[model samples]
Target chain A: DVKVTQSSRYLVKRTGEKVFLECVQDMDHENMFWYRQDPGLGLRLIYFSYDVKMKEKGDIPEGYSVSREKKERFSLILESASTNQTSMYLCASSPPYLATQYFGPGTRLTVL
Target chain B: SQQGEEDPQALSIQEGENATMNCSYKTSINNLQWYRQNSGRGLVHLILIRSNEREKHSGRLRVTLDTSKKSSSLLITASRAADTASYFCATDSGDDMRFGAGTRLTVKP
Candidate 1:
């Protein structure tokens, strides 16, 4: 079984704070994705990385950045957290050519 | 937009009955996958069917894909109360990925 683990399950931060969310996948998948799950809006992609140090913006990448320094680790960074950034964040990984993604447990961030 | 759209946003059924959810997409896809997300959590991959495949099954889940119609359907047989969750269909157009709004299914006990 593949396991994807997130650094935090829940977090709270003040406005304009910098927030970091980390994800690690044991499967060593080549593709990693970050998404924000919101009510009514569903899951919208934030950013995706195909390889180490390579990242691409998804549908909703504003105010968010990502880093892939290693194969098993992916990080999501919020430059300046705002109340609108409060939502459930999900991290997923997939094999090079496969579309089936294995997701982490998710981090619910609350911006005050 | 490449985002898929699921029909019948919400459905409630009694346990032991079958639950069906449908998904339709706008663009050509290489494959379509179904995922289930529990309340306040991440999604779980349920099944995947390629564009060339018609139907596939796993456990009590049945998935059917029709490329001509750009649609897919998922059927859960003998559903249980634990089956209550939001079901999403994601489409893969080569390197791009998009997910639908999802159908919230409630299987009453």
Candidate 2:
């Protein structure tokens, strides 16, 4: 069974603080993604990594950055957390050439 | 930008009834997928239909895709209370996949 695990199920941070959300997958997938879910925005991709040390920005990547130093781990970093960044953060991974992405339980981030 | 948009943002149905939701995308896609998310949980991959295919089915879920119209539909038969969740449609193009604002389904027992 493919499993994706997030570092935290919930988190709260103050404005201007740095935040990090981690995701790990056991399936050795080549593609990993980060997204933020809002009430009306759905899942908007923040960043994606196709291979180790390779990253691509999605539609909304201005306030976030990503790290993929290894194949099994992907991390999302917020330079300066703001209230507007508070949302349900999700991580997903998929095998090479596969469109089906397995997701980890989201982290509900609250930036106060 | 969002690629897919689902119609009927919210739906309410009773147990044993069939529920249907529609999704329309703006661009050509390689494949379309359906996902379900229970409250406060991660999204679960439900089904995937390639652009060349018209319909596919799982236990109680049926998905139909229309490439020419750039749209798709998902039908859940004999929906139970456990089926209540937010259903999302996603389109895959190249290496990128985008999701639509989901349709929240409420099944009243």
Candidate 3:
């Protein structure tokens, strides 16, 4: 079975604080993705990595950065958390060419 | 920018009834997939229809794609209360995936 796990199910952070959301996949997939979901915005991609040590920006990546130091782990970092950044963060991983993504439980971030 | 948009932003239906949701996308796509997300949870891939295919089915879920119109529809037969969730359509053209806003479906028991 393919399993993706996130570091936290919920988190609260103050403005200007650095926040990190971690995701790990057991399927050994080469592609990993980060997205933020808002009420009307649905799932907006933040960043994605096609290979280890490689990252690409998505539609909404201005306030977010991602790291892929290892194949199984991907990390999303918010350099300065703001109230606007409070949203549900989702992580997904998939194999190359297949494009079927398996998602984690998600982290609900609350930036106060 | 979002490449897909789902119509009927929300839907409510009784158990044993069929539920249908529509999705429309812009630009060309190699494939389209349907995903379901429970409250405050991550998404689960439901089904995928390739560009050349017009329809596909899995268990109770039926997906139909119309590439000429850049639209697709997902129909769930005899839905159960457990089927209540947000349904999203995603389009991918070999690189990354783009998701729609999703349709909130509520199935009453």
Q: A-chain TM-score in candidate 2?
A: 0.99
Q: Docking category for candidate 1?
A: medium
Stronger candidate by TM-score (1 vs 2):
2
| Candidate 1 residue pairs in backbone clash | none
**Model 3, residue pairs in steric clash:** none
Off by over 4 Å in 1: none
Model 3 chain A: worst 10 consecutive residues (lDDT sum)? A35-44
The per-model DockQ list reads 0.68, 0.88, 0.82
Top-DockQ candidate index = 2
Question: Whole-model lDDT for model 1 versus the true structure?
Answer: 0.94
> Where does candidate 2 stray beyond 4 Å?
none
- Model 3 stretches astray by more than 4 angstroms: none
lDDT by residue for model 3 (A29-91), tens: 999999999998879999999999999999999989999999999999999999999999999
Superposed on all Cα atoms, the candidates' RMSDs to the truth, in angstroms, are: 1.0, 0.7, 0.7
Candidate 2's interface RMSD, please? 0.6
Compose the digit string of candidate 1's lDDT tens values, residues B1-109.
Answer: 3379998799999999999999999899999999999987789999999999999999999999999999999999999999999999999999698999899999999
lDDT tens per residue, model 1, A4-110: 99999999999999999999999979999999988777789999999999999999899999999999999999999999999999999999998899999999999
